[model samples]
Target: MMGGLSIQKQRRLIVFAFITVPLLLLLTFAYYPALELIRLSFTDWNGISAEKNFIGWANFKEVFSNPEIFGVFKNNVAYFVVGIVQNIAAIYFAVVLNGKLRGKNLFRLLLFLPYILNGVAVAYLFGYVYDTTNGSLNYMLGQLGFDKLSETSWLGNTSIVNYSLASIGFWRFMGFNMVIYLAALQSIPNDLYEAASIDGANGWQKFIYITLPNIYKIIELNLFLTVTGALEVFDLPFVLTRGGPAGASETFVLKIVETAFQFNNYGLASAMSVVLLLFVIIILSVQRYLLRGKGE
Candidate 1:
């Protein structure tokens, strides 16, 4: 009993025990892989190779210089644009649903339901909806006596193919964005609105002067998520079109996968991933800079 471990030592041991496992996991799974990716980015190693030849920044150079390689960003732009529109729509809808309307919770659920559904399944469902023949959209159009519109190939035409895929993303993410906005809206103190009302402020004025200011940080968060999500979009297109119609809808991340697995260009793929990471940092930095005085 006299030589028993002190309480201080026991507390320290407990703390160490609690943190040790998580620290090991982070190093092994997260830090190690990220470091490996950066290392691989500088090498010209095919996916299966044990020998990774250091090639400096040739992969990066190719990424920047080659029009063919950078062209995939056009598809990403579609998602970015769609995401912007989706955010606007979601925020507005969130505002409306925040009103004293009946069945608002049901409305919120219906909006958020798509987001909780399986992404692959939604893609497949939309893929069928956009099918060239016997698709629901075409069938509906035909029924409406618009045979010419009915014949239009939604997913096949290169011109609108990216947009068609982005529409699916819009459908899937609108609810999620709305839920975010709604949560932010709910957090604002009702006292602010009462004060606004006492000051002869109407709904629109209250939204602009009170609601908007109160939820500024949340709006910033939604903007960041929208941009980043746009950049990293892969699943919808991969599931629906497989980036088909002659790579018309191939997103940036999809192209990365194709580079590594399909073309055995792991080095380029790794470099692309690095570029994407840098892009996210740069984008969020710019976003913060622009939004500085306005929001934060």
Candidate 2:
């Protein structure tokens, strides 16, 4: 009995090591970098040769007080709002495609192709589309008796740059969101719809009662992903507009990049990042609460 117990103990130790090793690696690589970023947020240090001082909240205050930062925050909000609409549009499109139709597979593949394209490539392509004078958009405008609009600077104008950037994001992400909604729609049991029809439900009634309720979780997931993606949006706007003519489309990520790498203010960037994290946490919490309330 003693020998058997010793062997079992050794097996348990081996199992524990196997489980813990990967966790340790994940913590070392992922969690440590996040923690370090948070730590840097509280200090005054440049990423350059290490000679650092401590300053609590000063950088955050500066970030918050700046009009440019606030404008960027507004742009982030617009991005999320626009992204939500884009996802909704995708869901609608997915629903249409989910039904039996000729050429459906080909259509889906065509729509999804853009999402698989390199993001930088998409950004540069739109850059040409939004080009002030010699672009395709301008040529179309000239044909539409709107030649004046053709010369308008899409990226340079503060009032419209965020909208332009959001449009690019919508185009880039719509196909991916459609695929997600399509998967969710396919997962739903069709019997529910058949049952609803048997009970004298019409198309609208069936959709409202059967389709919407069944896909609540998927909608929640998509909402969370869209919000996070929009909030952290950087690459598209970065490549297309480069935050543009007057920082019109700048986002928190851009601000952080400018602070850390451009200005060599690593500590300030860190503080800004911490604030951004807190802001994201707050938004996510509110979303959870609202979703929970709705479900109840």
Candidate 3:
């Protein structure tokens, strides 16, 4: 029995080692760099310099004092709000596509196709679309009765650039969300709808009571994903506006990258990154707490 126990312990150790090695590697490679960045946020160290000096709270104060940072923060919030709208729109579109319709597969493919393109490529494409002179938008507007319309620089305006970039997010992810909702919709039993109809419940009533409640878990999951995705928005804005003409469209991730790579202020960027991580955790926790359900 003692020899058998020893053999069991040895096997367990081997299994644990197998599982732990990759995770430890990930932490070593990924987490240490992140932690180092966070620690650096307390200091003033240029990326190229070997000399590191600690300046506590100063970097944070500078970050907060800069209106551009907060302006970018506002842009992030706006993107979050727009993302909710986009998710709702995606669900609606998904519901439509899930219905028995011709070219439904084609519609799904078309909608999701934009997600496959490189964000930088998409930015350049839209740049041409919104170009002030001889652009497609201006040409369309001119051809329309709005001949007096000014040729608007869609990517250049601080006020509209965030939304313009967000529109790309909407177009790219809407199809993905639609597919998720479509899968959820398909999972819902048809008998519930039939019963609702038998009870003289109208379409709206069925949708509100049956369809929504059934898909609430999916909604919760998707909302969590969208919230995180919105918070971490970088590529689209970076490529489209590079935080823009006046630092208007900068997101939290973009700010972090700019601080670390561009400004070589690694410490401040890490601090901001930690804050962003905390923000995401809080948002997700609140959402999960609020959306807790029997099914989930």
Please tell me which predicted candidate would have the highest lDDT against the true structure. 1
lDDT of 2 at 248: 74
Q: Which digits, one per residue and each the tens of the lDDT, describe model 1 over residues 1-296? A: 32488999888888997999899999999999988999999999998979999999999999999877788888888888998999899989999999899999999999999998998899889978998797999999999999998999999899988888889989988999899889899998889889888999998999888888888998888889889998999998898778878989898899999999999989999999999999999999999988998854
The candidate that wins on TM-score is 1
**After superposition, candidate 2 runs with Cα above 4 Å error:** 1-14, 293-296
Point out where model 3 deviates above 4 Å.
1-18, 148-150, 294-296
| Candidate 2 residue lDDT tens string, 136-224 | 88889989989689788888898988888888878878888889889988988988878887889997787787778877887888888
In model 2, which residue pairs have backbone atoms overlapping below 3 Å? 41-270, 41-271
RMSD of 1: 2.2
Between candidates 1 and 2, the lDDT winner:
1
Q: Write the per-residue lDDT of candidate 3 for residues 223-274, one digit (tens) a residue.
A: 8888888889988787767887778787878988988898887777767777
Assess every candidate by TM-score: 0.94, 0.91, 0.86
Greater-TM-score candidate between 1 and 2: 1
Instruction: Give candidate 1 regions above 4 Å deviation.
Output: 1-7
Estimate the lDDT of model 2: 0.83
Worst 10 residues of 3 by lDDT: 63-72
